[model samples]
Target chain A: MENIILTSSPTTPYFPEVSFDIDKGICEIRGESYMEETYKFYLPLINWIKDYIKLIKKPLVLDIKLIYLNTSSTKCVLDILEILKDYEDDSGQVKVNWYYDKSDPDMIDEVEDFEAESGIKIELKEF
Target chain B: MTSKTILSYKGPFYIELISVFGTNIRNFNDTYSNARKKLFKIFIELSQNVSNYSENFHMVNNVQRIGVGELFLKELDTAYCFTTINQVKRTDAEILAERCEIVNASDQMKLRELKREQRLNSPGEKFGARIGLIQAVMLSKNQLEYKVENINENFSYFSLTVKIDKY
Candidate 1:
């Protein structure tokens, strides 16, 4: 399977920096996302994950470092999480680690919400 | 070129000025961060709604279609109050009112659960209207209040206020 790489730009509405390493099966989505067309921007990322699950079948690690995302972007993030959850349910090795600033309690609460909503265990790491 | 009439229509813009002034806070840096993020998010959502659904203008960049709106942030003694003002068609106002009622009625826990379920089941592109508002409230840890004033026969001015307590 080919590796998928996308660099996020701040000029756009949803400015998220993405670094997905297909070789190591490690993907990181960071920065702020408040795009006018959120789902359109996230579709490729979701499709990549789905394709990876079918082909690579490796342990997938997701590092989330989003300091701020709008409600629309949050929904898209959840969609991405749901796909990962499905992979885990099929017994594919997957671990999601959410990194947030220690001083940012809002980010922590958001991660917790994602955990409760998706029923996927996410490791919260404070930096 | 009389100065008096030139500034007489300082209607909604005045409210916008007030909202901008309220954003200045002395303490609680964390609260400021959260409020600023939420304010930007709200601005995008509300402005898009005006652009997409408003019947008066079909073209995306038409100046008339752009909703007249302003956001104000006030640092109260113990809390920060954020307010937004915009003009909406009467029909849009009704729909907005219904959505606000539903969001205000739900508890925080319930709203979070709803947001999660909606995210999973909802098609990625077609995000429902009220969900964004509900999620914003939940994320900000604040309560929202709205008032509708009849303008002409077919339009009304809608003002929304959200308050976040400083901890």
Candidate 2:
């Protein structure tokens, strides 16, 4: 029920800043995710989304503006998208947007692939 | 050692080492921003693979921990080559060699499709779909070259190399 807000740290740029507002139905994950133990970091966020979709029953908007994310974190992102996909399947309103650096084609390809694989429409924007 | 050698680290592949090496590479003057991102991404994926799966380990403070490996970055005329060497069980070496071969032969589209398939089918596996190799190949935008050398009956040394063109 409480919103999760984590400030960004320069020392461990791998861990991103996560802001999930329970009331606003807006979740934003920004920064590089290169955590050594990725599973431990992502499980809670995944559970939180599941809780929001089930308990809040409100429209959700997920915004991701990440500079870098490793393969494990990529898997986590996919897990999050899969959750959103399932929510949409159940007639729950869900929207996802990925803001990627225009210079990084790899990031763009990744977002497109995620959209294709998850069967969830992700609005891709370049900035 | 070649005069083109930019940097090299040989020893236990700790988790934090990846970020340290990445930061240094990012600060290199010759590396363009896009290329630097790709370089760092490939470096982390390859190095972490060594950290997570390398079979060789050294005991520290009465605890057996993940083993050691070597990472080297060398400059060429127009590209920078990143290479990692680590110890693996024979079975893992065989699996990794086969995966590298598969990745080496695929074009970008095929690689993308393969990554998507792996992500969808095995997303929750301990290593999260084991897509590290594919991601490295995608970011490096080059073929993966690897060699598996017999170290002993039980283990073999696996070396993987990816080259990123410096622009």
Strongest candidate by DockQ: 2
- Ten contiguous residues minimizing lDDT sum, candidate 1 chain B: B1-10
Off by over 4 Å in 2: B1-3, B58-65, B123-125
DockQ result, candidate 1: 0.33
Evaluated at residue A4, the lDDT of candidate 2 is 92
Candidate 1 lDDT tens digits, A1-127: 5566667643342468887788889988887665545677788888889989998888999999886676678788888888899999999889999888775666777788889777799999976
TM-score of chain A of each: 0.91, 0.97
Q: Per-residue lDDT tens digits of candidate 2, residues B1-167?
A: 23398889988877667788898888767547777778888888888888777887665687536558998998787788999999999998988889998999999889988988887787463565578889888887888889999998999999999988867
After superposition, candidate 1 runs with Cα above 4 Å error: A8-13, B1-68, B128-130
For candidate 1, what is the total of clashing residue pairs? 7
